[model samples]
Target: MKPRILYLATADARGHLMRAQLLAHALIERGAEVEVLTTSDEGATFLGEFGIAAEVLSRHYAVQFDERQNMQRGATDGNVARYLFDPRHMLRDIWRLRRRIAAVDLLVNDSFHPALLVMGCLPGWRRKIVHVYGASLRRALLDNFQGRLPNWLARGFAAAISSELRRARACLQHDFAYAAPARVAPRLFNLPTPIALAQLPQQVQGPRAAVYLNPHFRDPQLATGLEQGLAAMGLQALLVGEGYAGRAGWTPRDPQWIDAAAHSALIVSAPGMAALSVAQVYRRPILLLVTDQPEQRSNAARAADLGLVHEVVCWSGDARLFAIQVQEALQRLRAVAIEEGADAGSQRARQRLDAWVDCLLELAAEPR
Candidate 1:
């Protein structure tokens, strides 16, 4: 019998959907039945672009962000509070999710969602639940509650987080680097970013830049500044992101973006796990466009410490200054050495994916 799996991916950014799509395709290839549910219509659209069908889960919540991509703490808190107070909507989705969970052999939650996190604590849910998220996200969560909140509230938050982690059958925390996987805890595994690449057609590195911005980045001037910076650097830029799709100089969504990025002279993107993984895998120099978001800020700092980032760009409400930073970063990145072939990085990604697939199959086959 085929192992049946349900995947719930949050749509705060496209990275979650991208990971879900990749894992869904892989599991299907491995003879498992897979169903994907996303938190928002935007996630469904993103999956649709890649020829993947997804259903939108109702009453899903997302963290709020500002126009410059800064996380809005008070707004997000209010949104969550509203959702928590709406028992009708909350219970409706929870009941729906519970039924789906019972039907599937396993439920994989990519990143975190309030509905799944709530369901995870219920009886009989842990044996069938597996959590996947980036390491930086884990760090940011810890940072949020440590010495930043009231002592009693911080402890309460920490305890809730601990409870959720304990409830999961396994936690797959992925990070950047071409390193060996390690067992961080009895049920937690620290693995390389589970990115699988397709065979690339023979192509040489070109004098072009590949750029991607998530939907959270809403500043129009940043987009304008990016163009000016690339122009100044004498590099043609191929921009891909849902946020900038219809804008002038922004290209339509291309499934072959990985190929373009692999062969480009430089890569530019927000320091999301997906972008960072791609940069490391292809051994391409990257300029990280960071914002005040804790997860992204942590990722940028870590990447720089590891010598993985070639440059870092932060917007201070100055488009001209932002452009100048980008230009200088690109110039510096040009001098860095890129490996002739990405055999090592590809191997690491493949290994991570294989490990995840193996774990899923193993869990699915276990006795109920």
Candidate 2:
């Protein structure tokens, strides 16, 4: 009998939904029945782009970000506190999940929703949950309380995170760069991003760039800067992301974005794990556009430390100044030669995917 899997994805960022889409597609190909539930309509729409149907959760909770894509800690804290304390709504969602999990053989929580986190820590559900998230996210959570909260509150928060992690059947933490897989904790394993390399279409290399940004980025000036910089370099580019749909010079979201990325001479995007993984897998040089967000900042720093990024561009608070920086960065990035060779990143990701699925099936087959 095929294992029925329930994947709960959080919509705080697009990376979580992307991971869910990739893993669910792999599971379906392996004859597993998979159902995806996401926290927001945005996530549902994103999954729809790749022909992956997902149900939007009724109780929505997302980390707040400012217009510039910077995480707003206070706003996020208030919303989370209200959502967790509101018994009428919180309990309704929790109970709904409780009923749903009864029918599934396994629950795959990607970066997780708060309600799902609560449910995973429950007596019966923890045995079925396999939590998947990027290491950067785990860092963000721990970094949130650093010197910002009272000592007691910080200790309590850390304990809560550890307790939740301890309850999960397994925890898979993915990284951006290639590294030897390791068992990080009692139930936690660290590996490369489980991207579907087989699905990435081969495209002829060209002197163009593929640019993508998530909806969380609402800086019009940054978009303008990107456009102007690419134009100044005389490079043909396809720009896609939230807030660029109806605008001139911006292309609609192409389902073949990975193909485009593979064909392009350069890849430009926010410091997202999905984009970074794709860049590495395709062996393409990527220019990271870093905002004030801690996750992005940290990711960019890591990529640089690992010598993965071709160039890094930080926002200078002025569109014109940023445009200049963009042009300079691209000029430098174009000069760097890309070596043609075997796809090591893709090979590693495929291996990780197989091992990930094996873990899932093994857990699902265990006697309850």
Candidate 3:
């Protein structure tokens, strides 16, 4: 029988679905039967473009954030209250996933109900694998340490999760620019195959830059100001995101944004997994915006430290400063072509990804 792999991921964010799609494509090429179970219709639509089969496991009714950005805590108190009051909803979804687990040779999770639910229950459910980018439980622990949870409580929670981490056959930590192993598997990013890029929409000819904004905590005035500033810089900006339908001059596009990023001179957005992956693949200089979320803040810091991004700005500053910084970064990017340096980086990233895929296949081929 052919090896069958089931991928479980939250579909609310584009990053998770995109990564899962890329990996699924790779698995298919290797002759594995892959099916994705997600929670959003958009995710299913996006995956459809890749010719991947996606099953909608749950319909999420919470506040939808920018598909390109991570949702911040306390940003929607009512929504959070609803979730907290109804934990059984998530548990029920897990029960459904568990019913299908028996046929899966491997289960890959990327921050979804499956990881928190199914994996915690089956204990030996297939060979569980986790692909983590930004904003994980570790970052959460760091961010929530000072609150009502005492040190012992926090430590205990961490320990429990850590044990689960060990249970994973492999943990692929995708840092965007590069992946590092979290525990069992070496770290790796899901690098785009040249064929994948070729399959994307043809690059539009223009002085274009890709601007990504998370609509979750976005201040409309700030976004408008930033967009205006970019336009003033004489570059045609492609704003790709979930929200902002009424935002002037913004165009709606689908999965093609990944292709658009390949041709962009620069990419401006919070340091998200998908954004960072595009930056690394195309060797584009990044103008990173720090979000209020601690995990996102840490990701921005890490991107700056790695020399992958050209400039970093936090949203806490005044509008004037934000404008000035955006312009300055654009100027710097114009003077320097970071994409030229990405060839070597891209190769390195690809090798790491190949190794991870190989490890998975090898493990599956071995006798249980």
Clashes of 1: 0
Alpha-carbon TM-score of each model against the true structure:
0.94, 0.93, 0.80
lDDT of 2 at 181: 67
Candidate 2: where are CA atoms >4 Å away? 178-180, 184-186, 198-206, 341-349
Sliding window of 10 residues with minimal summed lDDT for model 2: 197-206
lDDT for each candidate structure: 0.80, 0.79, 0.61
lDDT of 2 by residue, 1-368 (tens): 99899998888887788778888888888888999999888779889998789998664477988767778889988888888888866777888888889999888888856776777788898888888888887777766787888988987897888678778788888887756567777678887776656344454444789898887777788888888899899888878887567778776466677667765788999888888877777778898988778777778888877767578888877889888999999999888888654356557668877866776776677765
Candidate 3 vs. truth: CA RMSD?
A: 4.2
Highest TM-score: give the candidate number. Answer: 1
Q: Name the 10 consecutive residues with the lowest summed lDDT in model 1.
A: 197-206
Could you give candidate 3's per-residue lDDT for residues 1-368 as a string of tens digits?
66777887676556677667777777777888888977777677767876777998767434334332445445444553455456666666666767776776766776634334336434566354544434443455444544647888877766665566556555544455444433333423332221124133354776788776644434665676577668668888888655665667664335566556666678887766666666766677878876655555666666766567567766543667777777877888778755364345446556655655665565455554
Clashing pairs in 1: none
Q: What TM value does model 1 have?
A: 0.94
Candidate 3 error regions (>4 Å) = 60-71, 75-88, 112-118, 124-138, 141-148, 177-206, 215-218, 316-321, 339-353
